[model samples]
Target: MLDLIIRQGRVDDEGPLADIGVRDGRIDQVAPAVREEARRELHAGGKVVIPGLIEPHIHPDKAFLEQKMPNRSGTLEEAIRNTAALKARYTAEDVRERAERVLEWAVRRGTTTLRAHPDVDPIEKLMGVEALLALRQAYADVLDLQIVAFPQEGIIKAPGTEELMREAIRLGADAVGGCPYNEAGITETRRHIDICFRLAAQHGLPIDMHVDFADDVDDPRYTTAEYIARKTIAEGYQGRVSLGHVTTLGAVAPEARASLFELLAQAGISIVMLPATDLHLSGRKDRRTVRRGLAPAKELLAAGVNVAISSNNIRNAFTPFGLADMLQIGLLLCHTAHMGSPGEQMAVLRMATVNAARAIGIGDVYGLAAGRQADLLVLDTERVADVLVDQPDRLYVVKRGQVTVTTHRTVEVHRGPGTRSGERPAAGPSRQADRIREGGVPR
Candidate 1:
């Protein structure tokens, strides 16, 4: 017998209604109707079912620190300095508590995976990594958490951070991370990138660098994105290197941006757009004319580059606001990136789902397909087009064939004026109300 079966569900938001059978924590069959018997049956009632989305980038250790240390300056430098102060007081327990709260929100909102970049600098020492490492085990069933040993303070400038980053990987980090922009100067920043690549090569891990994270394309600080893209090809890290933030691409000369896009596509590098943090921390130095420091998603997609959007932070000094919701991220991205048409809206959806899963190298086993891991979201909306507009109630969240988070909401409908519901008194007994049946129920 199948472990679970979900029927009358909509896939791709608009495809033909499909029924999925799950067994042994994997999707067993997908068809218009699944007739086999099952131990448990979930009636979607024509709800929308989609692959569980992914948050390709986030900093769980630094999450929820906005209250403790606020960044009044609202600049990247100030955020880093203030966060370092908060990190100093961090203990294993402290980090885990905050991280757990964030995870609870993410999973409840239908995010089944996250790439958590926990700092590994000397000031924070190993406290953040240790907390997230344990969280990886604790939430393994709920979250496919990928930890990155992020040298947020810069490996070269911080001196001992390189060792700490390596140690973090040894202690269970899944990937190597770096904030090359946080380095002292162009030379130090270049060297920091070299060190990150070297470490990833040594440990055979993927590289996810925070590169080109400024708003002023003319500034010399926006130096590492092209360098990282070129080096990715030289070091044979294609398809394994991801760059986060990349906000400066918007301000660069169109020709230069075009060249960079080509290089990124050639290297198979992924661009993870972090709108929450980038739009806040970046462009802070610009006074005369402020720039909207967000990645050029439309241009990058036009160039055939892999692009995805993520919530880089939540209630941290860097972002100050977030709820770990990818649809919210996509909707905001649509506004910032000017992607509002029907096709653009759907493309933004892919940014949070398929593109996100691929950014973290989890696409193969992470979709609403037969034989894939049973991670899915069932929304109360019948059409995929209304999923975002309605932000439909999430009826069911299935992870590994086991129902995880389920929410049910009820709406009271007044049938007619004579029914005296009075919820909408302005139009008491309209012709629409005449459609109500004799039992005061809408037909």
Candidate 2:
């Protein structure tokens, strides 16, 4: 007997309907009709079924800290300073509570995998890592949590951060993270990147870093993409590195930018675009016609470079608004990055699924096909192309063939007799049935 079966689901926007069979926590089969029975079954009713969403980068431990200390200047500097003050008072219980809230929001929104970059600095010490280690085990059934020991404070600028990062890895961090642009100068920035690469190589782990997060490359520290690319090639770390918020790349001269893109492609490094935080904290100095602080996503994809999108921060000083929804962030990118065409829109969706899986080093086993792990979503929309435009509800969130989250929402319009268009009806209480969820039917 199979574990579960999803019937009459459309996996493609222009393909025929299919049935998916799940058994032993993996997709057993997918065909025009699954010819076997299962202990439990779901009727998709011709709705679009997609692979589960993935968040390649996020800060769960420091999430929801806007209320504690706000960024009054709305600049990256103020955000960091404000967060640093708040981190000194962080407790295990406090971090756990806020982090759990973020996870619950993510699961309800159909996210099955997340890579959390918890701060590994002097103030927080190992508090964030310890809290997330427990969460990694507790939420294993519903989510695949990959924790990175992110040194938000520069390794050289902040004394003892390097030792603390090692301790975080010893406590079971999945990746070694860096913040090179936070250093005092370009020289320290290079040393910071060197230490991150050495740590990753020593431990046989992947590297994910925050680099070039400014409005322009006028600062030498923000222009380290080329240097990092060369280092990646020399160290033979191809396809094992990811860089977040390369916003400075967009400001580089056209001639230089093209060459940088080629170098990045040759290095096989993935670019994880943090649209929420990048758009929020960047371009602070611009006055008239402010620039959109974002990496050239369209050009990066055209250059044969792997690119993905992530939320990065939620309700924190860095990004004061987010619901932990990848689709919402994709739509935001579509608007800001000029990815509104049909094909471009589809690409944006992929950034949250397959592309993101590749960024977090889970591409081999994450997808919506037979032999892949049964991590998928049955969306409320009927067409795959409409998934982003409609912002439909995730009717069922399946993790390892088990239904972990289910959402049932309905809406009905009621009209009284003799109520004509452009005419006012009786002012009595009208009986209109509407069960709204998450901003009332997405429009």
Candidate 3:
């Protein structure tokens, strides 16, 4: 007998109706008819099933700080100051608690894997890093959380940051992260990139850096990210290397942007676009007209370079409104990037799922396939456009061979024909309403 069978589900691949059988934490069979009986059966007749989405960029440490500072100015410098204040008062327990909360929200929304960057500046003693490492072990059963030992402050500009970043990696951080553009000058930024790449190579870890976030194309000094990518390739490091939030590329001269794209693609560098954070940070200096400071997503996609969209910060330090939902990210990308075409929408969806998995170097066992892991989500909507439009409820979220979360559909009742004046039908309690009445909190 099969461990679990999900029938009548519209498999993402090939757009066919099939039953997915799971056994021993992996997908056993996927076909039109599986004759074997199963221990448990889930009916997914009117639902769309796709692989669990992955988020490539997120700040999981905001859950830990006691002081909740707001970015009143909404500029990068102001955001940094606010986060610095919060980091000053952060504790290990506080970070652990907050990371857990953010992660739980992500999983319920169909994000099973995340690459969370925790601030590991010189002032904080790597408290965020320690907390996330502990969380990785605590939630290993249901979530895949990778920690980036990030220097939120400029790596070379901040005092004693190099040692702190190396220490974080020593303490089991999965990657080395840097913010080069935030440094004072081009020379300092290059120094930061060199340090980050050197440490990554020394420790044999991946490099994921927060590149330029400027909205001006004439910022002639912002090319350290390209330099790092080239150097990383030349050094014979064959691991995953990613660049997060290269927003300045959006404003660069079209010719320069195209040239940079070629260089980055040749260097085998991937990019993560944090739409929410970019929207929050860019165009602050403009009074009458505001520019969307996001990277040239459509152009990058056209060049056959992998681009993944992510939720950079959640109701925490930098950004105060995020819930770890990739659906929301996709919708925002559609609006911000003018990706309203059917093909463009599908590509945006891929950014949150398959493309994101590629960005984080987890594409081998990801996506809905015959022999992949049984990580899937059943959405309530029929068409992809409807799904993005409604942001419908996730009917079921399956991780591994077990059901992680299930939400029953709520049927809406309308007024019947020949109804009496001011007479309404007696309202029956819904499964969700009953659960809410009974204080059925999310698991």
lDDT for each of the candidates?
0.83, 0.91, 0.79
TM-score for every candidate vs. truth?
A: 0.92, 0.94, 0.90
The most accurate candidate by lDDT is: 2
Off by over 4 Å in 1: 286-289, 411-443
**For model 1, how does the per-residue alpha-carbon lDDT over 286-363 read when each residue is reduced to its tens digit?**
777777788889889888898999999999889999998887887788777788765676677788888888889887
Candidate 2 Cα misplacement greater than 4 A, ranges: 418-443
In candidate 3, residue 206 scores what lDDT? 83
How badly does each model clash, as a count of residue pairs?
Answer: 0, 0, 3
Report the C-alpha displacement of residue 169, candidate 2, in angstroms: 0.9
**How many residue-pair clashes does candidate 2 contain?**
0
lDDT of 3 by residue, 1-443 (tens): 88888897765423467788888878898788788999998988856777888889998886423235667888888888877877787777777888889898998898888899988887776888888888888877778889998888887678888888888888888888988887888888888888887888899888899987888855544556568667867886533788898887787677777777877777767889999889888999998789988988988887767889999888754666777899998899899999876567777888888888888888888877777888888888654434566687888888887888888665655566886656656865532211111111110
Who is ahead in lDDT, 1 or 2? 2
> What's model 1's overall lDDT?
0.83
Backbone clash total, candidate 1:
0
Candidate 1 clashing pairs? none
Worst 10-residue lDDT window for candidate 3 reads 434-443
